[model samples]
Target: MAVDPRGVDLKRLLAEDSGEPLVMLNLLRFAEGGAESYREYARRLSETFLPRYGGEVLYAGTGSTVLVAEDGQSWDAVIIVRYPDRTAFSRMVADPEYQEVTRLRTAALAEAVLQATTPWS
Candidate 1:
């Protein structure tokens, strides 16, 4: 139900920083008519905010049939985005302009999982 990260969540993310690039794994379940709205959010993110914050979309795709997952665990979409670091991601979310368009993302999702990933050695 929580689409956006909270202040405490941000603090925890920063505290765990390893000074390496972070890849965010986003699992999304769209509400009715949410896909279109999410598309607009993606457009703004790819065109403006991502560049400003040194972030980029590594992959974005609609979810298909789940080969392996518990019942009611399938997602509507999956996206991977890379940020220079946790601080950059935190700053982007804090940006005034980015905040304006965040509603689109929030309104579009019934549920979401935003997880930060570290590369394997």
Candidate 2:
């Protein structure tokens, strides 16, 4: 049921200064008729916000049958997005214009997991 990060979450993210590129792992579950809405959100995000924040989609794909997972653990889609850094990601989310378009994404998902990943060295 956690679709978007909160202000506190962003603050916490910013407090950790890794100073490295971040990859966000997104696990999404759409509500009925929500995939279409999410598609629109994705289009707007890619065109308007991503470049502004130096972000890019590494991968996006619809989920299929889960070969291995706990019960009630399957997702509807998965997306991996790379951002220049945590600050860039934070700024993108806080942008006024991006906030307006985020409504579509909020409406589209029943549940989501947005996790920041650092490459293992």
Candidate 3:
């Protein structure tokens, strides 16, 4: 489970850019005592990095009462973030300061799914 993006991942994301706003869906499964750590990471992201990189968190919430899913498919949390473009997202991940902050997220997640989405036309 990858909690952080690698250089090649960023490169690939940029390569697939369509010059449109991108929405990223995050499904997180936390490690032991990881919720607090993730909260700290989220704090830094909302306060500094998101603003610096032109990104906004559209939704963030803890998962509960799974209506439909296979066993072990439940997530501890979910987040939706929108970025002006793929370039902005990649740049944020590449930022030296953001890289430091991202460590918290890495330590907080046992498994994660970060998927980019596009609006239906």
Candidate 4:
């Protein structure tokens, strides 16, 4: 099933098969406030990036992990998205939506790291 972070559905993805080896990642970060730019970026992504990435997001969501650190003390939300292949992920980041909104995301995020890994099943 697709459960990367809290974005989309998994079973409908095209680039990956549930039984095949999949890449998993855990995105860790410290972001807060619902009104911040990152939230807007997320909204825009929900509107733009999601559709743009399409199938790539499905493969990416499976086996993904997201963690939000302490509330008021520091961190906020964590995100993890899957990709059928590292190359596909690389391409997605270079896409126009990512290129623009990513910068906005960084500005809102205090600390973020994309932990891309392969999980053996």
Candidate 5:
């Protein structure tokens, strides 16, 4: 099952991000046990994507519990990447190299949700 860990309104959360002028952003709750390859994915993300576009990433955290207590932590990581805007984000998603890591990105996620947000305040 997917977990809802949000405690803040992301649109509001990003109100001050004028750096890249994020158009669309994705929130990822990577499944537990991806520790082995997380670094590799990060490397790919940094080298292959961030620079290609104009943006930065704000990683949330790693929770220490699961959906059900005693089940233990299920999320390997939590990430939020802000792109230059909707078009840049879309272009990044359609990039060939990103397509290659789609599987690994899938394998690492128990489930995730992406959102389109703008400043609320």
Candidate 6:
């Protein structure tokens, strides 16, 4: 039920760099009454941090009916983001300004799955 990434997580992400664009899959479970905060975080990210860090939100949406999953496995939202590279992603998370905004995301989520993806050859 971890809602935020730790320093070690970022370090591990960097260590696995492929020198190619990195895509991150985000599965979010919102805390009660926390949707608005997450929206605000997303807005700021799309408007400023993303551009500054060479990142783009590929897709974002609320989860609908679960097509396939365990009873409690349904997510509240999903977002896919692409970064120029793992370094760019790492830098964004380390930015002082971004650090401030990230609190909204952390507070909004009860649980989250933030996983990096590799495209097929």
Cα-based lDDT for every prediction: 0.96, 0.95, 0.94, 0.48, 0.60, 0.95
Once fitted onto the true fold, the runs of candidate 4 whose alpha carbons sit more than 4 angstroms away are 1-35, 55-74
Give the count of colliding residue pairs in each prediction: 0, 0, 0, 2, 1, 0
* Candidate closer to the true structure by lDDT (higher is better), 2 or 3: 2
For candidate 3, lDDT tens digit of each residue in 1-121?
6777777887888989999999999999999999999999999999999999899999999999999999999999999999999999988888899989999999999999999998898
Candidate 1 runs further than 4 Å off: none
Sort by lDDT, top down from the best: 1, 6, 2, 3, 5, 4
**lDDT, candidate 6, 1-121, per-residue tens:** 7888899999999999999999999999999989999999999999999999999999999999999998989999999999999999999999999999999999999989999998999
What count of clashes does model 2 give?
A: 0
Candidate 2 lDDT tens digits, 1-121: 6799999999988888599998999999998999999999999999989999999999999999899999989999999999999999999999999999999999999999998887899
Off by over 4 Å in 3: none
Query: Given candidate 4, what's the lDDT at residue 102?
Result: 70
Candidate 6 clashing pairs?
none
**lDDT by residue (tens digit), candidate 1, 1-121:** 7988999999999999999999999999999999999999999999999999999999999999899999989999999999999999999999999999999999999999999998899
- Cα lDDT over the full model 1: 0.96
- TM-score per candidate, in order? 0.98, 0.97, 0.96, 0.53, 0.62, 0.98
Candidate 3 weakest ten by summed lDDT: 1-10
